[model samples]
Each structure stands twice: as C-alpha cells, then as structure tokens.
Target: MKKLIKLGIALVAIISLNACTEDDGFTFIAKEDPDGLTFANTPSGSYTLTAANADNMAERFVWNAVDFGVQTPVSYELQGAATESFDNITVIPAGNSTNVAVTVSEMMDLAEEAGLDNDPTTAEPNTGIIYFRVRAYVGSNGGNVVDQFSDVISVTVNLPEQSEEEDEDLPKLYVVGNFLSASGYGTDWTATDGVPIAAEAEGNTAYEGFVYMNVDAPQFKILQTNENFDDNYGDAGETDGVYTGILESPGVNAGTPDGTGGYYLVNVDTDALTYELTETSWGVIGNATPTGWDSDTDMTYDSDTQTWSVTLDLTEQEATDNGFKFRANDAWDLNLGDTDADGSLEFAGDNIGVPEDGNYTITLDLSNPRQYKYSISKN
Candidate 1:
C-alpha cells in the first residue's frame, strides 16, 4: 500500500510539470489597439503616420513588441477594396516604416472601399474621384501581418477662365515725336532742321510738338542791300562825266529812292540796310560797303527780284571810326521784302550768305511761323 502511494505522488508531480510546460508554450496573440485610425477627415497635403503601443503590460508580454528581442520591425502596406470583406483588395508593400506619403488617388480608393461617398465622383457622379489610405505592418521573427488601416481622404480639382476686355486693356506704344498736320497750310507748324520732332505719350504727358532746345551762343547773319535800285536799272552810274544818282535830297526821298534817279548817285547812295552780328559781344569781323561787298555778300529772292541788293565797299576807317561792326543777339530779323509794294511781296527765298565760321546754332522763324520745317545745326 505504501508503494502504491509513492507511485501516485510521482504521477501527480509529473502532471503538474506537464501543465506548467503546456502553459508556457510559444503562442502569440496579435493585439492591435483601436484597429484603425481614420484620416479622411483631415486636410489635404502631406502627413506622417505614428505607432502607438496599446498594451499596458510589460514589453515582454506583448508579442512582436518593438522593445523586446522578438525582432519586431514595422513596415507599411496599402490596401484598397470595395467592401469591408476586403475580398478584392490590392496590396502593395508600404516599405519598412510606419509613415508614408498617401496619394490623392489612394485616399479616394480608401474612401470608396469604406462605402463612403467622399470621392467627388461618388458624391457628384459627373466629376472624377481621388482616394487615399495607409496601413502599418508588424514584422516578427515568426512572420508578418498588417496591423491596422487609416481613415480615407478625398479631393477634387477644377480650372478657372479669363475675359476679353482684360486682354484689350493692355498698354499701347507710340513713336516719340509730334504728328504732322495737313500739308502746305501756313497755319501749320514746322520742325527745326537736323532736330527731329517726335510724337510720344509717356506716363501722363503727351508731347505733340517739337521740344524747345536750349540756345547756347545764338547767332545771326548780316544782310546789307541797296534800297535805291529798280529791277530795270543797275546801280547808279557816271553819265557824261557826271554822277547820276537815285536819292534826291534827304527831305526829298526820305533816305530811299523811287528809282527815277534825280539828285544822289544810285551807286554811291549809302541807303542800304545794315545788319550786324557779333561773337559773344565782340566787334564784327565782316564789315563792308555796297561796293566792297565780296561775291559772298549777295543774295536774291527770285520771286521778288527787286526787293534786295547789296554792294561791298565799307572802308577800314569807317568800320574803325564807328562801332558799326555786326552784333549777334538771341534773335534774328527777316528783311527781304519790297517795302513799297501794297502787299505785292508775298514770298521770299534767299541763300544763307554768311562766311563759314565756327559751329553755331541757327533757328529760323518763318514769317508765317507755321509754314514749313527748317533745320540748322553744326556741320
């Protein structure tokens, strides 16, 4: 009977050891807390997925725990399906991480699989749809499995339009100058020579005329002409060894002759107009009398032939004794018309008869002011 009791105790002990060993068997229970997190309600753009340990137990009690020696390396995998059964799900390796960039299309797919009409097409069938979702993967020495899925997200895109008036309102460009008026009208204006007159609109100012140039050292040309000759007769001459003159007495002709030639000799008459030009207030270099005028001193207005004549014969004593040298000022005068005519002298044209000097700025103001464009500059 004692031997029987000993054998019973040994069997009991063996059973106890078997029960402990069976309880310690390597069995794993995957516990993913919350199962899934929904990101469909979040804003669009970029995001990062984070892992949360759900178990309150020590790290050793958690199977495939990241802290233990079970070699739990987490990866991510994306899945899209039409239903919760996930029978037709498409699985892609999300790589080795808990975070990944979720695309718009994937978000739309996730929304569709969740039976949610978050996709634009699903909500408004006329439009297209974009879907997205993400799933984390837990890898262990034994095997691997997807832990949970995030909520789905969706978005839509559209383009804008433009108008015609906006395109037409763009700024326009114009050439820099003034616009010319009808041709050949005396009331119209003309531009200075060599200097171009431009029409341009810049900022707030629209320039419609020639720019007034600064006159630095203005100049004038002296014009001396005989006032006692007619178009038919030449200068007064010696007839029968007596000098025949055009001017009668000073009281009789009033310093000008009507060409009948009564008292003073026409050729010797000092009844010509004298024009003076100076360089910076100095005395004139060009001094001449009617007989002393070189060929350069002569000019003719073909349209009004009898209006102007000159001779070169001014003596050096006459020029020195009197301050009769030419003077140059800021202005010039026009004196080539027949003063005796009843407006018969309508037009006048003459060449510039001044000697070539240094550079000068010349401005010609036509009698009508607006008849034509004239240009003058240093050559």
Candidate 2:
C-alpha cells in the first residue's frame, strides 16, 4: 500500500510539470476583428480597431490575463501606411480596449508632424491609398517584445473635383398699351361710313386716339414700323408719317378711350411711331377656341410683318372684359392697320394681353370692318 501511494504521488508531480511547460510555451498573437477587416473608400472621419482571435487568445493578450504566462504589462501599437506592404508607416498608441478608434484629423496632424503632406479630408496623401495594421507587445522579466502583427487593411478616400458651373440669368420685361380709334370719333366709337382714318388731325382727315406700352425695365429699346394700314379712299394711301399717341386707363380696358393719350410706341432706331398687323392671326386661327388660351399657347414674333398675334373665338363679353384691355401689360399697340380684301370698313385691331409664359389666340369678325379679337397664352 505504501509503494502504491508513492507511485500515485510521482505520477501527479510529473503531470503538473508537463502542464507548466506547456503553458510557458503558449503565445498571444495580435489579430483583427471580423476575421478580415474592411474599410470604406472614404472612411468615416474617425474609426476604431477591434482585436479578435479564432484560438480564443484575445483574453490572454487584450485583457492581460495571466493564463498566457504574461509576467508584465502589455501594450498595443497601430501602424498605418499608404500601402498594404506597410512601408513608411506611422505609429499610434492603442488604448486599453480590444478595439480603438482614432480621428482622421488627429491622424492627419500626426502625418504632418512626420513631414508628410497628408490631408485626411483629401486623398492627396499615400498616393491616394491608405493601409492599417496592429502590433502587440508582451513584457517579461527580460524586456518588452512584439508578439505578432495583424493582417493589413487597405483604405481609400474619395475627393470631389473643384470644377462646376452655375446657372445663367435670363432677361424679362413687362409692357402696357391702349387701343383707340384713329378717327375724330371717340375711341370706342367709329364713323358710320367705316372709312379708315389716320390718328393725325390733318390732310384727308384726322383723329384723336392713343395706346400706351410700359415695360418693367428700360433695358430694351422699342422698334416700330407700319405692318399694314388703309385709307377709306379707293387709292392705297402712303403710310407717309404715321405717329402714335400714348394714353392711360383706370384698369385694363376700363379707362375712357376718349381721355388724352399719354405715351407713344416710338421706333428705337428712327424715333418714328410704329405699328404691325398679321395677315391671318399668325397661325392661331383655329375653328374652336381651347378651354384656356393663356395656359396653352406661346406668342412668337412674326418676322414677315414685324408683329405678334394670338387668336381666340371668345364671346363679345369675354372679349370686352377679359380679352380686350388697355391697362399696363394688356396691349401692344402697333402703328399699323388692317388692309385686306375685307375692305376699309372691315378694319380691325387687337389689344393682346401678355400672361406669364405660353401660347394664346385672338379672333376677329371680318364681317364687321371695325372690330377684332385677341387671346394670350403659354405652352
């Protein structure tokens, strides 16, 4: 019995010695979190590091446990470079956690101190590439020694280019005008004979009527020329010296047409009064008028006649109230007249109202020599 007991004690001692030797040879290696680490093309302004171990060695190194035979303090160093090869690296201390985060700005300051022109906000450094790795230190009675390095991770920063263009400013203007008779009769009333007369008060005959145009800004100069005109006489009278008289209205088409006229549509180049008319309502002569002319069509310049025309088939009431107006931004009075086979008695003029932006139409009754219609719109 004594011999058996001594043998059991020897066996226990040998087992303990083997365990000690095995524990002393064990090592704690630095590792990376997520097995293999990844970073954004442009990393967040800051980042953190996490150490992991598949062999369950993290607690031994990261937590400074004694199980791994650590006799002294343990510290960590993070190295970064422009290449995964880790050449020309920068080192920073790792705090007391398995993971450590550092600000890109802070890292940039460190780079500057190291004689590198690296802007964390830009990708100008590291030849447009960045890399990171971790090293762990284990201290013993002899001295501190680096255990192992984690796999290197690549990082990239995307920077925006400096060249971009801005939008351009567009030009705009507002105009107003009045429509009055060119005969001695009141603006709203014309001679029963329907003889076309000039606004002047001399020669064959004279009349007192006027129209006005007002623009928001004075940036643009006016250009006026007679598009068409007719005299009641059989022979086509020369437009010799057509002039425009300016007038004002309480509201669009509200002021008395007989009131003394105010501003004239003078030619920009010649200083002569100008007027224009279209042969056929400028292509807006549809059989049926749409629900909203102002919302549907756009006014275009008629190069041939030097006039702008819009056509509408609205009723007399729509024409008088909403259609025909002499207020500001309501009309463009041309120094021209209507001279077609329809005869002098069928002469008509329109007071087109300008809306926001779009197309519109204006209509006229050829049967009646002295009256016409107009519409304004955008598309």
For model 1, residues 1-379, the per-residue Cα lDDT tens digits are 0000001110000111122233322212211212211121112221111111011110010122122233556555545454545566656454664333333344434444444432233343322233333454455427745354444433221111112233223222111111112111111112221122111222322111111111221111101212222221222332211212332221111112222211111112123321111111111223232322222233221112111222233322211122112212211222222111111111232222221222322222221111221212222
Candidate 2 residue-wise lDDT, 256-347, digit = tens: 11233333222111112222211222233111234433332323444323234454443221111232322112223221212211101112
Q: Poorest 10 consecutive residues of model 1 by lDDT?
A: 1-10
Candidate 2 segments whose C-alpha is farther than 4 A from its true place: 1-68, 106-127, 140-143, 162-379
Question: What is the lDDT of every predicted structure here?
Answer: 0.24, 0.28
Clashes of 2: 43
Q: Which ten residues in a row have the lowest lDDT in candidate 2?
A: 1-10
Clashes of each: 38, 43
- Name the TM-score of candidate 1: 0.18
TM-score each candidate: 0.18, 0.24
